[model samples]
Target: METVQSQSKNSSTDHHDHGGIFGEKTELYFAIISGFFFFLGLILSKLTPLPEWTSHSCYIAAYFFGGYYTLLEAIVKTRKGEFEIDFLMIAAAIGAAYIDSWAEGALLLFLFSLGHALEHHALNKATKSIEALGELSPKTALVRKGSTTEVVAVEDLKIDDIIIVKPNSQISADGVVIKGSSSVDQSSITGESIPIDKTAIAPNTKLPKFEEIDSSNVVYTGTLNGDNIIEVKVLKLSKDTTISRLVKMVSEVETKKSPTQLQTKKFEKWFVPAVIIMVVALSFAHLVIEETVRESLYRAISVLVASSPCALAISTPSAVLSAIARAAKKGVLIKGGRALEDLGSLRVIAFDKTGTLTEGKPRLTNIIPINGFDKNEFLEMVLDVESLSNHPLARAISKDINSEYGIENKHRSSDIQAIQGKGIRARYNGGNVFIGNVEMMKDAKITVGSEIHQQMDELLQYGNTVMLVGYNETLIGLISVMDVPRKLASQTLARLKKIGIKQMIMLTGDHQRVGDSIAKQIGLTDAKGNLLPEDKVKAIEELQKNNTKVAMVGDGVNDAPAMAISTVGIAMGAAGSDVALETADVALMSDKIQSLPFVIGLSRESRRIIKQNLWISMGVVALLVPATIFGFANIGVAVAIHEGSTLVVVLNALRLLRYDLKE
Candidate 1:
């Protein structure tokens, strides 16, 4: 059955870890209950010539006590049209009862229950490393209103709300300090294990230290407030906060199957039927040649039990669970097991242009003023118009103008009209300022200088998309804003290629120049640009048609459809939009592109482990079936071997929990 969380809980390791604890407790409860019935049956069987009816009742009770859950699960699965290992085990148990081996039936259930308990316990221990992740913001924030402190839910906060931070309190929102200084622990957010000192940071200054204790003017989310009391103005609300975004991204990591998982499923389709046929044929031949139907039937049951698909059934999930836990340790959250399995077979990975490979946030990479206009004047004009707009280019222009010119545009604009898909038109300084793309300026009859065109063209070569901001009939300046590449992007791409990835491709909605520039920088073999979400899906389908398994990496609404269409979809959880995260097959919890190779390595290792376990299980069945049929092994030994095979398969699959990858 599919399981989904009812509420958007804090993305904590606790949410996932608690499921294991639940399973473990349930197992222990079942085991204890089964043991009680087993003892009761033993007592009743020997007590005072107990009636045949009474003895049978006790035996049945003991059998049902241990196997009832399995029976229920089998029925549920039947309704769902999936006949699984649980059904096979139930059939085996009932067959033992039919053979008048009541005690043996009870014993088999007991052993199976015990094995389940052990598996849950082991799985719980293996996943313990992920328990610390998903710690959320403290439920409450200390809001400071004119020096009076009051506690409130973090979600209730609004922009510019002044919040107070006490020593050792987790910072509730992303904000800047208005007062005080202290050292903050930021290890949770940045993976640095040091307390950073934060003095009042100016609006635009140098980078803050990773760690130093001076909480005077520091601001970061999920970091500890130092020993000094400080006031902060909230820059973003809870839903828009960094941790909130991360939690959302984590929740959405891709859940689709990778190529390996699909192959495993396909293999099982054939492997299961073939093994069943072989087991039936060998048993029936022995029945025709050997003396007793009882012995032959027993041999057949042993073969069936020995060749149980439990190992195969368990292989993919165990390996994937282990891989996900390992990723969590490194600050990555892969949502589904299928995604981990598919990541290994990815031949080409398409990336979303805006955010997946680059910092989604655009910055002013270049600002060129034309026609003898003073750069500052051009900047002021553009910034004044852009400050009134919310487009990415506008924001980038605003941030750049403020950073470079040391002036905040306080002058208000009148009659601002934002043209959809073009630019913003506003009355500034008694003139119409058109700050937008060339289309916008052309529509407004604005002409740009030749030098500005040359500068814009040059910016495109470096992977930047330039926006033209013009006044009246002349272009004021060209603001070159590009999606910033991730710091580890180049090295991450190189590592991906080294891991046997061929035909690297990049897909984006941006212009061709931007896509080509990024593709070249990242050593891509090909690049596609100006693609919509559906277009991305077509590209993935094309790759599949050409026999190239592809993984699409994206971080926006536009990537959601492509993610669902790819062989493997990797969502950039660190910067991904909520829909992208929820739809992708695998999500990299952090914005680290390097984890792609790590995931692939883990999947390949897991697939190998699954194959090894299946063979081991089959080998046990092959050896035990012959011994039972030839009268070399008694019912006792046969039963032991049958049960032991199951145990061996389980133990082999458990090895995936500690399986290490070279990546």
Candidate 2:
């Protein structure tokens, strides 16, 4: 029952906070200050001929200043029996000091602290998108209380409260418009750059309610309103807003470790103990061979510092964070390192028909009159009845009819009803008007003649969804609608093939012919249609049975279960729906198919960089440990090589930040 503020506070206090210990600035400040003292000590010891105690004092001071937090963390983790990179670095530095190499120890601490600071800064920058989203919604809302409007904190606003949003202001909560009209920029939520026009819904219409959130009548939190005042009745509280859910998802994503990262952690558990044993054995060997304690101890300390797996530990997370940030900037949200890695190895990708490859908005494509009926009269009647329904096809037909003939309803129909998955039924002009799929006609016992059936077949062949319109007992006409493929859908599929995807399939609930037609148009390798949500899940499982890694792309409530069962679930246009964002492992914030290619390419590159980093880290340790034992490298040189490799691996991962789809 914690409030949002308390939840945020607790999350910030967790170890994964982007800005650690006060903030990035404080970490940077301490690193710089400690580096100055370390350099001063180096100058006194090597160049100034100052008293040894003076230089020793300065080195001790530098070590404590630069490594205090790291030392504290090492102790805390050690007490909990979890030895990490901090423990390794601190142990190495202290071992150098134990061997009277104060200058080398001080320098090691300073460089390690600097690298930690830089890593934090880079990670914080990468996660800034989530913070930016959190800031988009207004903190206060103007509530319309009786005759006067009063400003109140968004958290205090309740469901069903009417809030007034002015032009250019961010919405305070998710709600439905009750009055006025405007174009709202929902880019923060849906990643659609174009502002969508929204108007008030008519009272008591058969149209789906605002809870389903039709774009024309629903306004979401964090969207910017255009130049018109609108009254919105809140549907959700501030904590339950779409933006809040999005931020929460982004924050939790980093905690889900990738397979590679988990493997690296497992290696480190064994690697750390082995390194300690090696250091002890090397110290014993050196003492027996050379019989000089100072040099023997120094060599062992150098081995400890050189063989630390800092780079290996950082490899996957740094690359994953950078890629996630890059993808976020382009309106793609990679849920975690696991999804990013899996995307690289996907052999097959299954896509839902609606809202993934195609624009979910259908348009009126054709109208056919039957039994010598007048086309315009049939259209007018169909529009009148369909206007009362909230189906996408109905809206498209109504829009086209309204635009073409300037038809306006003179009177409201009575007893309007929606037959789920079929059509609409209502009383118009003292007679019954039916508009829906062919199933509705069959259910009503209306006979469709051979010629009309032929016409319907022709429409279906072209991937059009045909709706039957009947007046009383006789069929009057047919309305055909099509949801067209996105402009870049074909190009995206081609790119996926070129990137080594072996199979691409379309799965849908639409008619088989309609699905096949769209699949062919988009150049998919295969298509499966007439699927219920469970059918799609079975289809995904069938694909996986062949040992193919599958990714399912969809954006609907029905798609959720199938998406969950797939190897990876990608939600399209997820910014619009909290459920979509939460349900999928990855989310395309914008309704753009092109982002698919970019994300896949980025994942492959991340995997490549991770492998390269691991090789470099293990190679350096393999070479330097033997070299330090055989008297080829000194303590200072070993520390330099180790910290430098860590920096190189980090910088290599940062390359993902500049990766672009256009490139």
Q: For all the candidates, what are their Cα RMSDs to the real structure? A: 14.9, 10.3
TM-score of each predicted structure versus truth: 0.60, 0.63
* Model 1, position 466: C-alpha lDDT score: 70
For residues 200-222, what per-residue lDDT tens digits would candidate 2 score against the true structure? 87776554555556667998887
Q: Residue 547 in model 2: shift from native, Å?
A: 5.1
Error of 2 at 378 (Å): 5.0
lDDT score at residue 70, model 1, on the 0-100 scale: 57
Please write out the lDDT profile of model 1 over residues 138-195, one tens digit for every residue: 6788887775878988879988788888877889887777677665655344322224
Which number leads on lDDT? 2
State in Å the error of residue 292, model 1.
5.9
lDDT of 1 at 246: 47
**Candidate that would win on TM-score:** 2
